[model samples]
Target: MTVSDEDLAIVAEQLGRAPRGVRAVAARCPSGHPAVVRTSPRLEDGTPFPTLYYLTCSRLNSYVSRLEGAGLMKEMTDRLATDEQLAERYRFAHESYLAERDAIEPLGTTVTAGGMPDRVKCLHVHVAHSLAAGPGVNPFGDEALEQLAQWWPSGECASKVKN
Candidate 1:
């Protein structure tokens, strides 16, 4: 779970800057590179950071952006409104995210990233949470991950990056 120097290098390459409040490697790509990072609820400077799971792989980020641009968020939002079971599950995901973040340090905000419970604002956050928490935690996130193509053609993203 620890974020190693190699992981940091790859994350830096992914974000194009040094990441802050990164506590652990949340999830890895199929190629075994750091894909999602778990960040602290509060930053070093005492700023509240609600995003607990951060997506760090650029390729995956691009793919998720493409999905977002294609109106996937609207489609998911519509489904969430009509599908009671799906909505319930998504609510649980939001609660789980809040619980985890509160455990780290309470942000005192009900807003979980990616617009959980009511809408789908960002596929990137949902996918990161799904990848980090594993399947069945976030239905929308699980769907996003299912739709994503294998981004790491060159194997581990850390090894592929030039630091």
Candidate 2:
């Protein structure tokens, strides 16, 4: 589904409140639709640090292609300040892009033009707890991890796809 500019703007605005310093960029697709490039900063106490971000351009390849065609990717790339987490996420995205490119056409499989896998989109979660429950507290909390475990399905994506 195509996201509208208003929706993207709302999403980006909401991202400003993320607990771990997350942010997003609202960009226009070639079809004049909207998408977001979300970034999460890895920081302790507001110092500049590593970060991770995902480009949610599910149908915006034409726009991205045009940007690339105009040689803007290089300029944009130069302007970005990267760190370990950002680099890691970029590596993951690049690998995924290459894999999707190689698997397309010959495999007769369908994927979004913007490179996101069809299985999942728009994942966000938050967790909060008090560091001191009382004078004497159990720092290692319970139940939270179990709850998270219950939330996700267990298994490899390949196995699920094969099934």
lDDT of 2 by residue, 27-144 (tens): 3323332233323333446543222333333322233334446554344344234444443443444344334334422223333222222111212100111011211111111122
Off by over 4 Å in 2: 1-75, 79-81, 105-163
lDDT of 1 by residue, 1-163 (tens): 8898888878887898999999999998767778999999989999999999999887788888999999999999999879999999999999999999999998778988998879999999999999899999999989887777454334555455655
Clashes of 1: 0
TM-score of each: 0.92, 0.21
RMSD in angstroms, all models? 1.9, 20.7
The lowest-lDDT stretch of 10 consecutive residues in candidate 1 is 149-158
Winning model by lDDT: 1
**Candidate 2 local Cα displacement, residue 43, angstroms:** 45
Worst 10 residues of 2 by lDDT: 124-133
